[model samples]
Target: MASKLTMTPGEILREGELEKRSDSLFQLWKKKRGVLTDDSLRLFSGTSERAKELRFHSILKVDCVEHTRKYVYFTIVTTDFKEIDFRCTGESCWNASITLALIDYQNRRAVEGFRRHRFQRAASEAEEEPESPEQRALSP
Candidate 1:
């Protein structure tokens, strides 16, 4: 069955609580590690600065999930900004480089997902085609 609830970039952005939700999400990402400290803000600030410059703050939709090995994956969608997909797997909050890397990775994942979904639709259409008359003639 086709999903009635289709999410659009515009709709996600128009939501009133996006910024609050985004801040909350960042907090959750930090809380998941069970330690809240200045180091976390430092790491977040650096990452967010780069993201802001890259326009990630204009993001429309953001999704995050915890992977099997204590890693958290983040997916984000934006207007002029490209989609980001990344995973964080550092025990120490002081690892700013790793945090930045994960952010970049997540951005890549969002772009990849867009490409993947398009390819999947095309593949599904190709697979359901009826046999052509030309092919039947050639076979005989």
Candidate 2:
């Protein structure tokens, strides 16, 4: 049986607490360590077996709000309208880290998608092109 703890193949980037931030107030919920890779965020719960994942390609936007030297609040908005929120402990830059990671992931995905699309279009054009008369005349 496959374990539910299985994570996608990649290096872990950053990890920290999952918190709720309201204006000047900051509250820490479960200490969720976020593993950021080129494609996703895998959050392993510190107090439970629960895990949450957010894929960069599926994320429509990341909204980050910085408050006075104490905290940085951020939200991950997915294409499916799911909004996940988190906050950084005092002076910690978890929000910036997550935002940068997401941006890098998204850019990489976009480049790869563009390359694939270009390659496919080129291949399709080659296939659909009519053979030249000179080449046809030389065929057996």
Candidate 3:
């Protein structure tokens, strides 16, 4: 059986904490599985007058839904306090070029924590195992 990957919102936010503001914002985009559209790019890149106008009140919205493939798909919504379709993708698509850049840093950290927990559990189990003389001989 495959183990489940679980994480919390606090953990997700913390991962992106060290990134530059723009990159962090981009990661938020990925976390939500948002595809960057022309408008979104303009705003995110600070390239347009409209972008400048709304920059102050702009916010990223992200939603993650559990999918049938045992992975979560994130939906990203961006707004100048108004809804905008910036970027979008489906759950099973593994296009890392786009996905990796958008991943919320906090989510990455949460994943790392989960990995560490699994590793520690395995190590503890190994330490708890009883060893026979033959097993000890083989351990070397």
**CA lDDT of each candidate?**
0.41, 0.71, 0.37
Instruction: Show where candidate 1 strays beyond 4 Å.
Output: 1-103, 138-140
* Sort order, TM-score high to low: 2, 1, 3
Indicate whether candidate 1 or candidate 2 has the larger TM-score. 2
lDDT of 2 by residue, 1-140 (tens): 11225744466666666564333345435456766765777787666667677778788887875566766667878899877777767577776777777777777678989999999999999999997999899999
Per-residue error (Å), model 3, residue 4: 23
By summed lDDT, which 10 consecutive residues of candidate 1 come out lowest?
A: 12-21
Best by TM-score: 2
Candidate 1 residue pairs that clash? 84-106, 84-107, 85-105, 85-106, 85-107, 86-105, 86-106
lDDT per residue for candidate 1 within 1-140, as digits (tens), equals 11215632222111010111135455432322111221111112322333222233354545554444655465555556655544455342222433443354456667889999999999999999988999778885
TM-score of 3: 0.26
Output the number of the lDDT-best candidate.
Answer: 2
Please give, for residues 1-140, the per-residue lDDT of candidate 3 as tens digits: 01124543222211110101124445453222222321222222322233222121143544443344444343444454344322223333432222332344335456889999999999999999899899889995
Weakest ten-residue segment in model 3 by summed lDDT: 12-21
Q: What is the TM-score of each candidate against the true structure?
A: 0.27, 0.73, 0.26
